[model samples]
Target: MRNLVILGAGTAGTMMANHLISKLPKKEWKITIVDQYETHYYQPGFLFLPFDIYTTKQVKKKGSKFIPKDVRYIQEKIELIEPEKNVVQLEKSGELAYDILIVATGTKIAPEEIDGMAGPEWYKSIFDFYTYEGAKALRNKLREWEGGKLVVHITEMPIKCPVAPLEFAFLADSYFKNKGMRDKVDITYVTPLGGAFTKPKATKALHHLLEEKGIKEVTDFNIERVDYENKKIIDYADIEIEYDLLVTVPTNIGDALIERSGMGDDLNFVPTDKATLQTKDYENIFAIGDATNLPASKAGSVAHFEAEILEENILRYIKGEPLKAEFDGHANCFIETGGGKALLIDFNYNHEPVEGTFPFPGIGPLNLLKESRMNHMGKMAFRWIYWNMLIKGISIPFVSAKMSEKGKHLEETV
Candidate 1:
């Protein structure tokens, strides 16, 4: 039997395992998934953790639950990957060889990359919502607090869920207002980008929302270091921003194993074919999700869309056929504006987000680039879909892998 090994059991790896199990013949193939942790986190829900929108229980589940019974699940730390020998070395277990390998070891937040960011103040006054522990810590800090200058900053880009930091700022505004402390607190969003978001049109809309909500935006500020002693962040331009509570999204990098294996780029992200989702250097190895250095938003929806196309491409590879260049960097996200409303944005590599209907042209229950209660409902409902349909490799109806331009107004190409 041919052995297939998956590196991580995160969203991307889980979906690929489930999808492949159904497509590949069980009699001819043996599948194995490896991960150090037992629980699988709903990373997007991390953004709402500080606002008490989602509890730890609501956003976490055992990795074994989502993994299929047919596939072998190994819970252990990965020491290194012997790519040349086509084997994986675990910390405790012996080496395991594979006929095909999938590298889905996702990106992680490296707070240590920023000086003093993870020093004495970590989880006390300095917090990050990217991890479950940090989110829980932030929740405790936000709970008995009278309110002051709260700074939401992004240390760098290519972080998971690019819009999450902005969403956190919006949610904080709502949370403080609901507590009747809106007047007592001031919120500031700092980023290296020139605007609120990476995309141009969305940035304009987001900038307006920030201004209207009384949230300050400090743009184009490349952080030099965090001065924890002074409770301030020093940027490359020598600008200093002080804060009482700092919620930062630190620099995100791929798994350290990627660096050990010498198969990754400067940021440790595996160089993947933008169209095929296959590693640039290895024909038998594939990459997905935040693991790949694809020029796309590092979000869960992107992984879901990539899995659909990758499933087919994997089959084609086994048959010795030409792999389809189907992935289009399609990504869509719901920006929670709080107040029981949200806005949705849909775009791909060649197009920016525009105002229109979504999943249905001219008849969407969710509107694009416009805040609506329906969009909020859709955002909340996604958690259910993620557990039931998405991880099970069930394709979402009406949502194509390539973004549709039918409902959007595209005046300029991305």
Candidate 2:
């Protein structure tokens, strides 16, 4: 029997486990998934944690609980991935050979990459909301402390849930307002990008919301270092931004296992085919989620879309068939605009997010590029959907892997 091994048990790896369990014939193949973490986190919930919108218990569960019992689940660190021999060396367990390898070890925050960011000030005055611990710490800091300068900054792009920093800024606006201390706090959003978002149309819409909420914007600020002693962040251009509380999304990079395997790029993201999800260097190896250097947004929605395409492609590869080139970089995101309202945006590699209806053509119960209460309800409802449907590999109704352009208002200005 041939073995199929998967790395990491995060959103992507766990879903692949659930997808392949029923597909591969039991007599023909065996599946195994490895991750250092036993606890699986609903990473998206990390955004709401600092604002006290979600409790600690709501975001995590045992990684084993979501993985199929039929699949071999190893809760151990992956020491190395020797692609040349198709073998994976575990920290304690001996080497495991595989006929095919799926690398889904997702990206993570690297605060150390920035000078002084992860130094003495980390988890004290300066914090990150990307991790469970960081979010919880920031939550406590926000509770008793009277607000001062709350700077929501993004160190670089390709971070998980790209819009989360913006959501934090918006939510901070709402949080302080609710505390009746809106006048006491100052909120600023600083990013390396030229605008609030990546896509042009969405940026225009989102920038307006930033203004509406009175959150000051700072764009194209490439941070050189954080002056923790002076309570300020210094950019390469000599621009300085002072802050009492700094909520920053540090640089994001893929797992070091990819680097150890010599199968990754500079950032350790596996070089993968943009359409097929196959590693460019290895025919039998595949990659999914933030681990791959795909131009797509590194969000769970993109992973869910890729999983559908990959499941089919893997079956083709098994039968010695040419892999299908079908993934289109489709991504859907919910942007919280504060005050019980949110906006949704959908797009693919070739298209920017525009005003549109989602799932149905002009009949969506949700609106795109416009803030509404229904969109928020959809965002809140997604937490439940993620656990029950997304990670379980159950297909979400009304959402397709490939993007549809039927009802999008793409006829106007780009």
lDDT of 1 by residue, 1-414 (tens): 999999999999999999999889999999999999999988888888888888889999988999999999999998888878999999999899998899999999999998999999999899999999999999999998898899999998889998999999999999999999999998999999989998999999999999999999999989999999989999988999999999999999999999999999989999999899989998889999999999999999999999999999989999999999989999999999989999999988888888988888888877899999999999999999999988888988999988988877775555
Model 1 misplacement above 4 A: none
TM values, all candidates? 0.99, 0.99
Query: Candidate 2: worst 10 consecutive residues by lDDT?
Result: 405-414
Clashes of 1: 0
> How many clashes show up in model 2?
0
